[model samples]
Target: MQENKKTIYSWALYDWANSAYATTVIAGFFPLFFKSYYSADVAATTSTAHLGFASSISSLVIVLIAPLLGSIADVYSLKKRYLFLFSYLGILMSAMLSLVGAGEWQAALFIYILGNIGFMGSNIFYDGLLQSVSTKKSVDFVSGLGFSLGYLGGGVLFSINVWMFQDFEFFGFEDQATAIKASFISVALWWALFSIPLLLFVKEDKSTHISTTTKLKDGYLRLKKTFSKIRQLRHLSLFLVAYWLYIDGVDTIIRMAVDYGMALGFDSSNLILALLLVQFVGFPATLLFTKISEIMGTKGAIYLAIAIYLFIIMWAATMMEVWEFYMLAIMIALVQGGIQSLSRSYYSRMIPEGYSAEFFGFYNFIGKFAAIFGPLLIALVALVSQNSRVSIASISILFIIGAILLYFVDEKKGEKELKDALT
Candidate 1:
């Protein structure tokens, strides 16, 4: 699994590929488009509710199957092949989004939900590839670099879309809505094109135990073993619980922020600008986090990031001014990518190399299920109180619980156990 530098860089290119959807569709245009166009007939809270529902549904779908898929992948040596399949599915769905005309919220919602599945499904395999991309000592740096590049790449595309949306006539588009749809196509194309390097270059180590029977049987056997082994893996189990809680808040903020701003009566342009600020700032800050992790240690650095998130959530509760939103974005920019990247590297370090795909599948499955609660909570709060602010504020409790549980994880002990298990 020790790969060359070329393999590592090619692997990182997938981040550049997929992040277009992260920035443009998720953060930049889709929220505003959903509110102002497709759901124009509904109240802002209702649109936000629908968006939350879509996110929750997508997460549920992945939650049901990610671990099983991961097990099958580990047994069948299907990681790279499946990554491409999911990536293409996502790309096609993203491209199809360009066809949704005005007042087609239902169509847009369905397509977006499917596309999200593809995006998240592909990422599970992508994260599993970390073991193949770099040595243990370099994993933190490599992981940080991937996220940093994603920010840069997604930001570049989003900035272009922002210009096109801002100057629709200059781009020779009939309207801003059309310009935004064009951006969806661009995101899809960029994803498909850049994914070529990884597809062509980066490769997985072949599975040692090839299944003689059907994949379902093979996967079931592996999955059964994984479940039985789970109880013995104390630190990994504790970390997943902590991750579910904290990442619930983290992902809630990512998925709901633009929508939150929209319901707050913020201008779409201002919100997009805030999104851009996070992208540009997050790029360098992610690298800085790699350095910080080296100095403070992974768990320490993660705790520091979580503490800052606590302050950020508290600040989010009272933010009313556009300037305050901008400030909040800056704070998030500092920790967002770092926490995510470091979490990936730290988890990779603790898992048995042979079971990486299956373990990471469980990891991502937990993440997806954890995502369901935050959005549901936010949507219900918004529905009941008819105020986006209240729902947004409630996310802080997840971070609080997560940080507390994270303290119980013994990293060295966990790594030793996983290594011993592999032996």
Candidate 2:
């Protein structure tokens, strides 16, 4: 048990390491910097549209490849190698963000897509690492710990970047653009520095069943076989479908909420503060919700999380003040990590051991595909309404529909099926 705890902590540290990319590169500085510096020289909204399109394209590619890569890793016991490969890909691209210059919109977009692909692809393998590290009893708490540490780590680095962006002159940078670009360098360095623990400590299982060449071939073939077998797992399939829709809403909110706040005239400081609040608040709340899941079970906790999300959407729609935005941030922090952690743990509980990577590949398939709709919806609505606030409000429908479907799922039955399959 002590060894398991050590392994879990090591696993969670990777979350701590990489989340800086999500917070700084994805959420905090990059978008604003892109628009102000790299994209400003381009035609209006072309940069924004290009970013969306690039992300969408990369997401689609990852969706197609994730299952195959996961299957290959499982068959050949190459999970750690895959994790390193993708993590380095992200690191290389993140480091390249510092090189983006004015009038280099195409290059910027290409780098962003590469970085995003690396970020998303690494997560597929990182998530698969969970099965090898811990059992069902510890999954929720450990997953929550990862998210909590992620929030803490990402927030700390982002706060530093915010300070730098606000005070660029202190560092001999001429302006915000230079500081922001430098922040990308920091993100790359920080990610590389912190990732050492996991790479050093975590061990991959050995698979004697297949050679490397055959593993590659069999991985693709197994993906086809798994797709057909998915039909046999009715309840699990339904849950994946439901998770796909609802998690889309969640992902959309995380990606676009800051942009929405900025559009509503909130200053960068306030936006940063709000995000910081969410990070700190998420830390404890995530652990508490994990405990609640132990008492109430995964489905119940998820239902509660979905309910909270509904309230946040309604609250945001009616918000007219900065304080109100802060309030909403608190609400999101309380449930966001919990929902995501519990969902992953719940799904893990339902999958058989030998096929964990394959099953989670389908899980990633849903996740990647789900990520598409909300952003596209936001972009489309912003295009039509020219009102980012109103566009964001439209996300409520996803939560409502997701919550209703979640109610129909039988958690006990899913657990039974998973155990039977293992036996």
Candidate 3:
């Protein structure tokens, strides 16, 4: 299918929209605010455990409902509607965060859980709509475009939020805590405003009208068939396994990087600056990575990214200075978006037509489920050895194993097999 510029741009802009939540709320302020503001009365470790528990609950919810919802959306051709539904839920929850007062840790965690569910759940349908916008030949560029714009958009708002928090009185806020609360509202507005393009311009396949009871029955049957289909599609299965492993390492590093920096005794302000560096650098680097994929092939590009990540892990474990941590952050910025965007595009090429949402659900399922493992591994290693560095080094195993499995995945063969199966 030929790409529609309007549809493609609009579809990509949704990434530009929601990433404000990812950068500012998820990665930047929420953990700090939850720890110092909401959970201020509790012990530091207690707050940490509570935050971790909330994260697990959100991930668990998404893992449980992802494929089932994806299958149902496919049956009803309701990807767009589902996407907006979850996005709004997230948006509403984000706005609500501003209202939780001091010492309201439980309420904060509860709303954060719901916000996370909305953020991650909506992505299932958003990813499903990829085929509606771009063809195989154009998918790489289009995917890269979305991620690049995401970096830029998320960075822009996060920078302003950081400024607002740093110089609260300049922003006309009474104090830093009040400024942080106000930042949540900023993210909600930014997310809502940027999402308008996709709502207005992008389109999905027309929804199939059916009785609710039949829809549920057909959706359940389709979900079962999808499980069988994965078993039959050997290379697709292999890729998912590989994806689950490496992406776990990727996500673990993303979620844990700041914590690691703080563990190493770096100031929080510097760590936040490093994150800003990543956002700005990632924008151009992601586009460059797409060009590299064009030259080296998608798998080769992914392999290169995995190699870089491996090197980063090794360096992170041994590094001493705060500047060294900044260097590692720059390194992560280089390949982070490349690996992610390429993986999505690569997977897009292999799945059967008309089931993108369902397959992407499985894709997300593996990713979300894998999330639970890496953090636990880190915790376990920290408990047994009492070494944060050793725990950080442990993640390299995921990349190594993922790369070995990815070596055996033949994308050409997978596409051929899918076509043959369909025929």
For each candidate in the order shown, give its overall lDDT on alpha carbons. 0.88, 0.81, 0.87
RMSD of each: 1.6, 2.3, 1.7
Task: Write the residue-wise lDDT of candidate 1 on 1-423 in tens digits.
Answer: 656778888998899889999889877788889988878898888888899999899999989888988888887778887788889889999899899878899999999999999999999899888888888888998899899999988988889989999999999999999999999999999999999999888877665565446787888888887777776888888898999999999899998899988777788889999999999999999999999998999999999999999898888877888898899999999999999999888888888777878999999999999888888889999999887778888888898899888899987888887666656
Question: In model 1, which range of ten residues has the least summed lDDT?
Answer: 204-213
State the lDDT at 335 in candidate 3: 99
lDDT of 2 by residue, 1-423 (tens): 223766778889999999999989877676666666777775433544555566666678788888999998877777778887988999999989898789787898789888988988888888888887878778887888899899889988988888888889998899988888888989989998988888878777665665668877889897777776666666787788889888988888887777677667777678777887888888889898999998888889998999889889888877889999899999999999999999998888877677777778778888988777777777777777777667778988888888777777776677676556445
Regions of candidate 3 where Cα sits further than 4 Å from its true position: 41-46, 383-386
Ranking by lDDT: 1, 3, 2
lDDT of 1 at 293: 93
Query: Residue-wise lDDT of candidate 3 within 1-423, one digit each (tens)?
Result: 427888898999999999999888877788778767898787644555566567667877888988988899887888889898999999999999999999999999899999988899888998998888888889899999999999999999989988998889998999988998898999999989999998888866678878889877888898997687678988988999999999989977876677677667787778888888889999999999999998999999999999999999999999999999899989999999999999999999997778889888898898887776776667567666667799899999999999999999999999887777656
Evaluate model 1: give its lDDT.
0.88
Following a full C-alpha superposition, what root-mean-square deviation does model 3 have from the true structure?
1.7
Residue 343 lDDT, candidate 2, scale 0-100 = 93
Q: What is the clash count for each candidate, in the order shown?
A: 0, 0, 0
